[model samples]
Target: MPWEAWPEGGFPRFSEGEREARREKLAALMAENRVDRLVVYGTWGSGDAVHWLSGWPVSREAAAVWAPGEAAKLFVQYRNHVPTARRAVAPEVEVAWGGPWTAEAVGGELLRRGGSGQRVGVVGPLPAPAWNHLAAEVREVVDLTAGYTRLRLVKSPEEVAWLRKGAALTDRAVRGLEANLRPGVSEFELVDAIERAYVPYGGMTHIHYLSVTSPSAPDRCVPSQFPSPRRVRPGDVVTCELSAAYWGYPGQVLRTFVVGTELPTEVRELHRVVEDAFHAAIRALRPGLRAEELGHALEVVRRSGFALCDDLVHGFGGGYLPPVLGAEGFWTLAHASLELQPGMALVVQPNVVTPDERFGVQTGELVVLDHGGPEFVHRYPRGLRLVG
Candidate 1:
């Protein structure tokens, strides 16, 4: 069944209180930066960061700046000025519509807007020209990535509630595929099952990423479907990796399945070793543990004898997945020795290879940290499950 077939309330929206809390946090962030004002840019969901900060998402190539003294303002380009300004912001935030700017025009406006000599901060995946133009002014033009991200890492009560609803709906989608997936099913068909099951509750068009693999073609399966006619076989190792967005927030998940009745001894052992390593990483997860130290804990598994596929564990929330968003390569992880704090959420995946098997297993659980160690947000079987 298509996701549109599901009930309307399957994924719930954040309440009004949630929006207010976000604004309060921004007020605090501006105070902490000690800047007279902060500027943000981008559109669509890429603009979501600023949208998140100011309670407005931009529709045009515009800028939203928050001055510590008065209410925030959103300035837009021509054509989209009214609708973008009117539609993009929270009721509490104010919007300003401005026309297109040439390089000369932008500099003049910044100077006129009390931007000169101010130690302003800018955030987002902005064009170099736009960023440089802003940086060109001021005694200091700081990148508020860390300051903003730190504020973001901890979810508010409302965010937790919104994400939990998304996870539960995703879990239901996985369950649908679990029951119907089999040897003759094409990878594309499986992909369809996942998407069909995800919508109707505000899953929207921010597509999910899917990958499937088999032990034989360890290098070539399920990264995504290509309308393949290839049939699942007895020895195939099935897997899929995904992240789906609800509203503007993202929830990531991974699942593994094996074909046939039994596993080869080598595959079985590799699974067990990686599973143990995953548990070790979980045990080490808690508030006050260093991100690198938590990353280094994966080393214990390597020492204990699981060959790591990669050195990666991460901070995940509010974005789509190509792995690690907001940086180069397929993904990026934190380098600081900072302690993991409460309100932080993470996905702990420790999968690696054994001497004989060319492909190993990757299993994961989305976790939310609390006074307890780490609570699994989306639970699937920890050990491998064989699918016919």
Candidate 2:
């Protein structure tokens, strides 16, 4: 197969088990919600619903509808609007290339094929303009809220294996980049070091979020730059929030490194406390755990001493993440009593940041929940590094 050829091994080249898993989950939701037919719709960044049904990933916009007794139909956005939609969607999509349509029309097009008023379930964020369109057409829409989300919470064994590759790459990115970092390097230089180390290892830009911090201010990871402008001095720290990807699957890792020389006394203590909290969170993972139970584990860090800016951990994959993690629409069961199950991918980095105080403290790793406990995707490092 070429670099872009797909459907190899009976699964989409980018996602193994994603299509069948999504279909089964959506069908189950339709049955549970009494939806005779469901319009699992989306556009651009809202591709979650579409990806949740078909193996196709919509870069710009796309839609899919599933009927109880029929195959799902997919629709890609028009050419003038999104070129990538055409490339990303499978060529055999049941429905594609509509002349023009609102978000609701995207749904309506699929509904038309499936039959209207069929007790439809909607799975996308509908804009006001499109809401009117869907409202006038499909009167009944069960939110399908937890129905689909809960289904996505747990990963399959295959997803875990793929995520592990990403995690390994992220670990390499962190370790390799730090070895190249130095006192005179700018943020951009450091970013270059990270990605130069990272890109060859794994990915497309999907999970490339990273941050750099100085040891004097150890808590956070900021975006990268060219020249990085701000030079690292002796005793400075570089904190990284880097993730690697095998296709679009992500494995997040956060690690701190010292530049020039040794870390300060307070920074070392802060790192220790944060690492303690992080491992404690890992220990707390299991099939019957609550999402918010991590807050308690974070407190263990807070007590050991450090002010955490908030949020201990979050869900991962396909834009599904906590609001604290820069996600626009993830249903952060982060604070709820939601049960943690095996096979879920998680990025837990309990960072302690001070809005007014100097120097932050944190470290984190991606882990897959296993039957016995959480299995780390990213290799755990024993200590921070001192580059040059």
Candidate 3:
């Protein structure tokens, strides 16, 4: 089933006080930058900032304009959604039609809010046309992307609660996948089973990737992005890297399993290497740790004669946020070196790639850093599961 078929309430929301706190944070940054007004943008699929400030998501295109001293005015596409948006937002937020042309609509709203003499700040992904239009009407345009990333890196109490819930839903999905694991079942069937697992809890979408290989040809089989007609077989190594979202927040988890009996010796060794990297990086995931230090922990895999496929770790909020740990080449400089702090949520993915690019393993989990140490949000067994 499609995620749209699921109930709208599948995702929980932050309290009104939480939403106000976010606005105040942005407003403070605007003041520090000498920006007289702030314009936050959101699109159909990427509406984190708009949702952060207004407590309503933009299914199409939307913008929220804040003038520092007054309530924020939200402009969304389609007047029909105004009623729904109004119901989602706090009383202090004003919901209105941003018109089909978001750039023009937001531009006009900015002029009315602060006129042409005030400096304006932009955050999130704003269309170039809308950006140009707004630029013509403001005294100066400042990019608040970095400021927004810094602010969002640390989760509030409310955000942590939501993330925890998201993690629970993810755990349920993985269990559902495990329960349905057996020979003769097609990969697509397993995919459906995972998606169905979320509908009951109100999960919006199950973004996932699953692939399978025989023990003898672990390096020979190529994984499919989407499920194929091929059915599961005994001794096949099934690997999945999946995530499910609740109220726009998502938690990712990964697993590799043998369809029956034990894993091949080579596969077991690969998993061992990946697990070492996962543990080494997580041990450094504490309040005072630097982002680069956490990344350097992944160097263990290279020392073990294995390479990483992609990113090692990232800050997770409405979506992937700043201070990405792994980037460029795994051998090169790390992405960014920001300080780790309590209340930070992250996805620890230590994927191992063989030099031949055929055999690999992914062992990852959703984790939150507290003052004490790192806590696992989703804790499924780290080793390879044997499914019959």
Which candidate gets the maximum lDDT versus the true structure? 3
Q: How much lDDT does each candidate structure score?
A: 0.60, 0.62, 0.77
Ranking by lDDT: 3, 2, 1
Candidate 3 backbone overlaps, count: 1
What tens-digit string does per-residue lDDT give for candidate 3 at 1-388? 3344234653345777887688789878988898988888888877488888877767777888887678888888877888788877767889888776777777787788778998889988887777888889788788897688778888998888777767777877788889998998888999899887876776756477888777676543223568888788888888887787776677788888788877688788888988888888888778877676775666777788877765678778766765565634333233345778899888887777777778677778888888998888776666778888
Compared with the true structure, what per-residue lDDT tens digits does model 2 show for residues 137-162?
A: 66566677546766767777666766
Better of 1 and 3 by lDDT: 3
Residue ranges of candidate 2 with Cα displaced over 4 Å: 1-18, 42-47, 78-92, 98-104, 114-116, 200-202, 207-228, 321-335, 355-357, 380-382
The sequence of per-residue lDDT tens digits that candidate 1 reaches over residues 64-94 is 7666455556666655566655654565566
Query: Residue 213 in candidate 1 has what lDDT?
Result: 55
How much is the lDDT of residue 171 in candidate 3? 77
Q: Model 1: runs farther than 4 Å from truth?
A: 1-21, 42-48, 55-62, 75-88, 94-112, 115-117, 136-140, 205-207, 220-231, 304-306, 310-312, 319-336, 354-358
Q: Pick the candidate with the highest TM-score.
A: 3
